[model samples]
Target: MSRLELAAARLAKALDDLETVVSPLAKARESAAVAETKIAALDAEREALVARVATLEDEARALSGLTEEVEDRLDGAIAEIRTALSR
Candidate 1:
């Protein structure tokens, strides 16, 4: 083959090789973008769940306090009934 034709053929092969390399890289970038978006969404969801858990903990503490107060009142009533019965 002529030298010019050979050079042109080599150039075409080089372009094809570059495309082969660049195509996968482009696809990888696209996949990474999608993964980043999903991660951001999951982070937001996790934050919301954390906030909800904090609120539930506060409510549980309040309920525990109320339960203690009721127990105290019930104990006092039971002691009074015992004294009356002993009289």
Candidate 2:
């Protein structure tokens, strides 16, 4: 072959070899990007769940306080009824 044709063939072969090496690296980079996106989504979900749990815990504490108040009133009423009956 002529020198120019030989040079072109060598350049083409080098490009093919480079592509073979770079193809897997490109795929690995894409997979890493996808994994990062999934991790971000999971983190957001976890934050929302943590906030919901905190709200539920606050509600539970308020309910406990209300329960105590109701019990105290009931006990006082029962004592008053017993005293009236004895009189």
Regions of candidate 2 where Cα sits further than 4 Å from its true position: 1-13
Residues 1-87 of candidate 2 have per-residue lDDT tens digits of 999999999999999999999999999999999999999999999999999999999999999999999999999999999999999
lDDT scores of the candidates, listed in order: 1.00, 1.00
Candidate 2: TM-score? 0.70
Task: Candidate 2: count the clashes.
Answer: 0
How accurate locally is residue 58 in candidate 2, as Cα lDDT from 0 to 100? 100
Question: Per model, how many backbone clashes are there?
Answer: 0, 0
* 31-69 per-residue lDDT for model 1 (tens digits): 999999999999999999999999999999999999999
Residue 32 of model 1 has an lDDT of 100
The TM-score that candidate 1 achieves is 0.89
Q: Please report how far candidate 1 places residue 31 from its true position, in Å.
A: 1.4
